[model samples]
Target: MHPASAWLANESAHIEDEADEHDLHAFQAIRRMDEILVNNFMVFQDVVEEGCYDLVVGDEAWDVDYFLHENPELKRFAFAWMTDFVGWVPMPDGGEHEVALTADYNAEMIEQRARYGRVRDRSIFVGSPEDVVDLPFGPGLPGIREWTEANFDFAGYVTGFVPPTQQEREQVRRRLGYGEDDLLCVVTVGGSGVGGPLLHRVLDAVPAARRLVPGLRFLVVTGPRIDPAGLPRRRGVSYRGYLPELYRQLAACDLAVVQGGLTTCMELAAADRPFLYVPLRHHFEQNVHVRHRLERYGAGRCVDYEEACDPDALAVAMAKELHREEHAIPVETDGAQRAGEMLAELI
Candidate 1:
C-alpha cells in the first residue's frame, strides 16, 4: 500500500467499532479530504502533465473528480459500486445521520462546482437501474451528471472474475480435501473488523448447526482486519485468514453465510450459491442500497443481525439453507467490457 493509504488505514481502523458514530467519522473524513488532496495535488498534477492522458478514470475517487472539475482540459469518467452519490441512504435509526453526511457531501460538491465546474463528464453506475432511484432527497446531485436510467444500458455489476463451471467447482472441492458427500459452508465478513461480532456469533452456532446436519464442515474466513487466532477452535470448524480469489471458493461451497457487503453477496449470487446475509445494524448503504439490489435479483436470505445472534435460530437457518436449490437471477459478467467500451468512446 502507498504511504498515504497506510496512514489513512491506521487512522480509521477504529471507526468500525463505533457504528453509531458513522456520521461523525464521515464528517471528519470529509473535512480532512481537502487537506489531503491539497497536499498531493501538485504531485498528481505533475504526473498527469507528464502522462498527457486522454481521459482520467476514477472508481469512487471524489478527489479525482474534484481535481478534474478544476482542470477541465481532460475528460473525466467516474464509476461507483455503491449509491453513496445519491445521498438518500435510509438508516435504521432514521435519516438524521444520513442527512448530515449528505449535507456535507452536497456542500463540498456545490462549493467545488461554484469555484471550478462539474466534476465529471460522464459517470457509470456499476449496478442495476433499480438501485438508483429518486429518494426523498433526490437523485445524483450537485455537479454529478450524465448518470440516470440511460447509464443502465451500458452499466452492469462487475464481479471481477467469472463464476466457476461445475467441473472447476469439483476441482476446487477436491483440492480442498472435501469428499462428494461432505457439505462445505464458507463464512466470511468482508475486509473489515466490523464483522468480528458476526463471526463470533456464527461460531457460537457451529455446534448446533453440526448437530442439525452431520458431516457439515465450516470454513470461517477471517479477512485481513480480523485475526484467525482470536477465534476459538471447534470440532467440524476451521479458520483461515484472507483467501485470494475467494469468489471461486464461494462458488464451490454448498452454502455461504456472509455480511451484507455488495461485492461478496453479488459474488455468491453470480455463482448461483445459496447464502444468508446479515446486514450490519445502522449501516445505511448495506441495509438500504445493497438490500434493494439483492432483493431485485431474488438472491440470498436476508438475516437480521439480531436474529443471527441467536445460535439456535442461526444454526437452524444454516441447516435449512444448505444445499438448497439455486434460484437467484443471473448477474451480468460483461460489465468490465461494457465499461471499457464506454470509456473508449470518451477517448
Candidate 2:
C-alpha cells in the first residue's frame, strides 16, 4: 500500500478481516503461539524491546545480520533467514551465536554478488561453512540460481514457490468483465512503496491507447501509496484501488504494461502474458535485480522512464512488445507453503 495515502479509503479491511480468522498461516498453519517472523527489518527494535515474543525470526539476506549483531543475547531465541551472500556476521568476543540461516538465492542473487562482496571480508564477518546451520532453504521462486552445495554449510534446493496456472488467465479475465470481448490492458507499478510516477505515465497512455485499439479498457491500479487525485476520468479506464489479489487482474489482461518488480513480472509470466517492462530509474531492484533475471529469460522488453514519459517512445516500445507472441519463465510456487513450514519450525 502507498505509505502516505492514509487519507484515501482503506481497501485492505477485507484482508484484515480474513487475517482475524486465520490459524497463523504463512509461517502456514500457524500455531496459536509461535515465534515472530520479521519480514520487515524496520520492526526489529520493537519486537526486541517488547521481549514478549518467544522467538523472533529475522528474514532478510542482509538486514538480519545487523539486527543480530546488536543483540547477541537474542540469538538463542532467533531463527534467521540466511543466504549464500557470504557476508561476515559479527560474533560476540570469539563466540558465535548458534543462528540458523536459510537461503533461497535465485539467479539474481548470484548476479548481485558484488553487493555482498563489499561486506564479505570486512573484518566483522564470521561467514564460514561451519557458521551455517542449515534448515531446508526457500523454494527458489521466480528462478533463483543454484550454487555448489560444498561451498556452504548445508543447503539444498527444492521446487518451492507456486505460480498461477495458465488457466487462471481466463478466470481473471472473466472477473474483470463478464461476457465481454474488449481488449483490456493491465497497467501496474507494484505496491504504493514505488510506482507513483510510473502509474501517472501509465494512465497517460490510456487516452492514446484508446484511440489506438478499439473497445479498449484500461485497468489502472492505484495502490495505497498512490493518491488517486488526477486519475483519468476516461470512458474505458477502470480505476481499481489497491486490490490485494492484483495478480488476478494481471492474469486476465491481454497485455501488461508493468514496472520491474519480480513478483509482478512472475505472475504475468505464470499466466503466459507478455508485457512492456519499464524499469524504475536508478533503482537497483528494478534496474539490476529483476532486470537481468527477466531479460535473461527472454520474457519482456525493457523501457526507461524517460522514454516512457515520451508518449511516442512508450508507444513504440509497447507496440514492439505486443507483437511478440510467447513469454514463459517457469517458477516454483510451493515456496509459499514450504517457507511457512520452515518458519513454523523456528520454535
Candidate 3:
C-alpha cells in the first residue's frame, strides 16, 4: 500500500516515499496532479472564464467542475483530456465501467467510440484529440492543434503542467552543480506511490556505468519525499532534491533515465533527447505505454529493474544503447509554440 493511502481522507497530504525501506508507495504524482488542478483552477477560475479559454487539460479530478461551471461559453468549447489511459472512469456517484478513447495512441485525431456502459458519467472526458492528446509523452501536445483545425475550435488552454522559465533553469543548474561538460542525467526516482527500484539499481551500478562511459557524469533528481542519504554515493553521481533546472538539464544531457511518467517523458521528448525508461513494477498500463515507445517506436530501451542489479548486465545494456549508431529520438522543436498556437486558435 502507498503511504499516502492513510492521508487519502484528508483534503491535503504530504506522504513520504517509503517503498524501498517501508511498505509504502509514492502517491506524489497523483497528489501533485490533483494539487495542480485545485490550486491553478482555484486561482484563475475567473480569468479562465472571462478570457474564454477554449480547453482545460488535466490528469485528475479536483476543480474540474469549477472550471467548467464558471465558463458558460466554454461548456461547448471545453474538454477534459486524460493523458494516461481511456479504459475506465470513476464517477463521483459511485460507479465504474469500461470506457472508450476518442483517439488512437499516436494519431493526431479524435473520434468517440462509446460511452461508459453503466456509470452515471458527467463531464465530457476523452483520451482522443477532441479531449486529450494520444501521445504518452507531452511532446505530442502540439499535435492537438492539427486535430483541432479539423475537429473543434480549440481556443486558449488550461493544462495541469507548465513549461519552466529560463530563470528557473539557471537556479536549478547552480544548485545541482552542473558543469558544462557533465552530462545531466535527469530522473524521476520515485513515482506513483513507488520508490524507483530501477533508480537504485542504476545507482548501485554507477561505478560500472562510469567504466562503460569512461567520463559520464550525472545529476539524478529524486522527489523531496525521498531522503537524499538513502541514495548511494558515487564519484560521478550527484543527487538533486526536486525537478530543478529540469528543462535546461534535459536539454543539456546526452541521455536520460526515467520512469514512464507522462510529465517527465514529455519534457524529455520536448528536449529532444534519447531516454532509457524503467516503468514501475506492477504498473501494467504504464509499462505497456512506455514499452510501446521504447521498444516498438525505437525511441529507447525499457530495461527491467531486476537486470540492473548486476553491474555487468547493466554495463552491457548501457553499452549496447550508448554504442547504437541510430540517431537520437526526434522531438518536435515547436511543441510549446504549437501548443500556444492551438490555444490561440481556440480562443
Candidate 4:
C-alpha cells in the first residue's frame, strides 16, 4: 500500500477503495518482493517507521534530515527544486546533491539550492533541467537535464527520464476532443490550487481568442488541486477537470497557456508546444525560479496575468504565441532509465 492509502481511505473511501482495487494486482506482486520503496509523503512522517523501507527518495520537504537521523537503518536522497519552503534538503550518507533547475535559473537560485543542500554538510552538486525532477526525476519530466545545462552554471546530469510515445499522444488528444482541423490549446494550473481564481482572468479571453482565430479550441485543465466548476466556463470551452496524462495532453496541443510550474513548462517544451506562462505573483518559485527563463527557452514568455487580464490583451498574447518557436535549448530525453540507475547507486 502507498503511505497515503489509509488516509485517503478515511477521507474519501470510494475513491480510495477504487484506487486500491485497481492497483491490487500490483500491490500483491510488490508484497512478494525482498524490498520496496514507497513514495515519501510529509503526512505519513510520524506513522512511517525507520524500517519502513530500505531507501526513501523524495523531493524538497521539511525535516528530511530529522527523518533520516531518526532512522539510521534507511537510506535517503532528495532531488532539490525551487519553492517557498525549501527548509534544508540534506541527503543521507556521503551522497551528492542534484538540482533540477527551473525556468528562472540564475546565479542567485543556483546558490539558493546549493545553499539549502549544503546546510549541514558539504556535498557534490549536479544540475539538470527542471523537467528531470518534476518535469520530475526521469522521463517523469523530459528535457530538464538539458534545460539546466544550457542556462545554469552547473553540470547537467540526471539518471532518469521518460518521454511520451506517439500512441499516447493520440489517445490524450482524442480524449480531449481534439479535432483534425482544430487548433488545440492547453491551459493548466500546475496542480496548485493557489492561483485558480487568477487563472480565470486568462481563461476569460478564450471566447474572443476563438473569434479571432478560426479552428482554435481551448482545453482549460485546472489540475487536481483546483475545482473546474469554480472556474469560468462557456458552451464551447474544454474545461478538463484533472487529466493525469500530462505529457500526452501537452503533446496533442498546438499551444499552451499555463501557470509557472516547472513540470508544466518542461512538458510543453518536450512536446514542442509554445505557451504564454504566468508564474503566480509574489511566489519565489514562479516569480524567481520560472519567470526569467522564458526567453531563454523560446517556449513562451511570462505574463503578469492579473495586470494582463483584459480579454483583448489575452487574445493578442495567444495569437502572438501561435507562431512562436519552442525549446530555446535542446533537451535530452533519457531520464527514466538514468534515474532508476542513479537511485540504485545511492545505497
Candidate 5:
C-alpha cells in the first residue's frame, strides 16, 4: 500500500480519538511502527541474508524517514546514495543530518557514534555515476537521456506525460471525473516544506492559464503536512487534500504544475505524465534537481517562481509544453521497477 493508505489504516482510529497535536503525532508514529512490524519488513534481513533486494532509491528525507520508522533491516545491503541537491533533515538533537544509510566520514564522530545502532553492518555510501558536478555539466549522463527517450513520447511533449498503460489512463480519468473530451487537467503536488513557494506561484499562474484555456481544471494535491490555506482556493479547481492517488491524478491531467522535488518528479515521470515545473527560489536543491532533469532528458519544462508569475511567459511556456501536439521526453524505464531491480542487485 502507499504511505497515505498505510497512515489511514494505522492511525485513523487514534487520530479520531485524540484531541492534542502531540498525541496525534505519537499515535501516527505508533501506527507506522505497527505497519513495519506486521509487514515483517526486515529490510536488512531481506537485503543481506535473503538477498532479496537490489537497490533503494529516494531523496534523503524519504530514505531517512522511511527506514528510521520501519524497514531498518534493509539498510544492511542498501546503497545509501545521494545527489548533491539534498538539504539535510533536522534530527531531534537540534542539528540536521543527511538521510544516508551510512554516516559521512567527515561528520563528527560523536554523530557517528549516535548512529551506531542505526547504521547497517554492510552498506555503501555512493554519489552515483551520474552525480551532477556544476551547472556547466548541463545534464548528468546519457543513461538518463536513453531512459527518457525510450519511454516517453517526444513528439507529443505538449500532451503531457504519456501514461504507461491504457488501464492507468482510465483509472486517472475516473478518479478525476474526466470524460474523454476533458483534455486539460493541470496537477500540482507537494504542499509543505520547500514546495510552498513553488505551489504559491502555480496558483498565481492559474489566472494566466485560465486566460488561455478558459475551461481548464486545476487538480492540486497539497501534501498531508500542509494546510489548504497555504494554496489559493479557486473555483473549477479541485483540491483533494493529501489524497493517495498522486500518480493517478498526475496521469489524468494534460499537464502537471509542480515543484522540482525528487519524489514528486519521479512519480510524475513514472506516470509518464508531462509536466511544467517551477523551482522554489530559497530551496537550492529543488532548483538544482529541476535544472538537471530539464537538461538531462527534457522530462518537463522548468518555470522559476518569477517566470511562473509572468502571465505572458507562463502562458507561453505552459502552452508549448502542455497543449502542443507533442509529449514528454521519456524517463528511465519504470523507475519503480528499476529501483526494485537495483535493490535486488544490492542483495
Candidate 6:
C-alpha cells in the first residue's frame, strides 16, 4: 500500500468528526493526491515493463488511466470504472462562486486528458444517468457509456450477497443467534473510523428504541478500522469486529443504520431493507450525489447528523423506520456480466 493510505484514513476520521475543519482537510487531501498519483505511476510502470498485457483496467483509480496515457507507446487498451460522476461538486464554503470553481477544476482535468489523446478506450458508469448528479457537461460526455440501473448489475461489484433468499436470511440470523421474533437492527459505519461518533449515538438510542419495540436487538459491526472494544457495552446491543460477509448479515436484518457512503446504502437498497443513512456534513458526494440516487430508488431514509446526535430524536426515528415497509425499485444484478462482455470486445 502507498504510504499516504494510512494518513488519508486518519484524515478521513478527523474530517468526519470535526466538520469545522473541512476546508483545511480538503486542502491537505488535494495536496496529497499528486504524491499518490506519482507513487501509483511508478509502481504501475515497473509492473507493466515486466509484463505484456492486452488491457489495463482501473477500478476508480484515475492514476491507472493517467499512467497508461502518459506511456502511449505501450499501445494497450485502457478501461475505466467510473463509480460516480465527477463534476458539479459543491464547495465547502457554499459560496455563489462554488459552481464556477468546481466546473473550472473539472474542465482542467478534462483538458489535460484530451491533450493526452483519449487513453480510455472504453469507460462505463456504474449507475444510470438518473443516479448521477446533474453534471455541468451533461451525461453525453464523449467516450463514456452508462449502465442503466436495470442493466448495471452490482452483484459481483459491491457484494456477493446481492439479495439474500428467505432461507439464506434465516441461516444468517440463526448463525448470529437471533430469534425469529426479534427485530434485528444492524448498525455499520462502512470501512472508515469516522463512523465512531455515529455508532456511539446509535448505541445511546438503543435503550429508548428497544423500549418501544420490545423485541428489538442491535448488532453493531465496528469495521476493520474501528476497535470494537472501544465502544460501550449494553444489553440489547451486540458489538462485533469486522465480518467478512457483512452484506449477507445486512440483507437478513430487519433494519440497517449506516453512514452515507454509496456502497453500504446501495447494499441495503438491493436487499430491500429499511435503513437510515446519516451523511457527514459538508460531504458533497454523500449529501448530494448518493442522496439523489437513493431518492430515485426510494431507498433509505436520510437523517442529518445533528438530528441523529439527539438520542431521543434518533430513537424515535429508528423505531418509526424499523417497522416502515419499503417498496424500493429493484437494482439490476447483471452489471458484472455486461461489463465483462464490453471488456471482452476490447481484447
Which residues of candidate 6, in runs, are more than 4 Å off?
1-32, 67-77, 135-161
Q: Report the C-alpha displacement of residue 334, candidate 6, in angstroms.
A: 1.0
Over 259-299, each residue of candidate 6 has an lDDT whose tens digit, in order, gives: 88888898898888999999876676777778988998899
Worst 10 residues of 5 by lDDT: 151-160
Alpha-carbon TM-score of each model against the true structure: 0.81, 0.62, 0.56, 0.63, 0.56, 0.84
Cα lDDT tens digits, model 4, 102-181, are: 22223333444344543322121223444223232222233434434443333232323355666766776777667566
What digit string (tens of lDDT, one per residue) describes model 5 on residues 34-56? 55444333332333455454544
Q: Tell me, what's the RMSD of every candidate? A: 4.3, 13.2, 9.8, 12.4, 10.7, 4.6
Better of 3 and 4 by lDDT: 4
Error of 6 at 19 (Å): 7.4
Candidate 2 stretches with Cα past 4 Å from truth are 1-55, 61-63, 82-167, 178-180, 337-347
Off by over 4 Å in 1: 1-14, 17-51, 67-85, 95-118, 138-147, 150-153
The TM-score between candidate 1 and the true structure equals 0.81
Worst 10 residues of 6 by lDDT: 142-151
Model 3: per-residue lDDT, tens digit, 40-146? 55454545545665565543543554344333344444444333333211112222211122122223122221222111112222122332433332233334335
True-structure lDDT of candidate 6? 0.71
Sort by TM-score, top down from the best: 6, 1, 4, 2, 3, 5
Question: All candidates' lDDT scores?
Answer: 0.72, 0.51, 0.49, 0.52, 0.50, 0.71
Pick the winner on TM-score between candidates 1 and 6: 6
What is the TM-score (0 to 1) of candidate 5?
0.56
lDDT of 4 at 232: 69
Off by over 4 Å in 3: 1-85, 88-186, 190-193, 294-297, 341-347
Candidate order by lDDT, highest to lowest? Answer: 1, 6, 4, 2, 5, 3
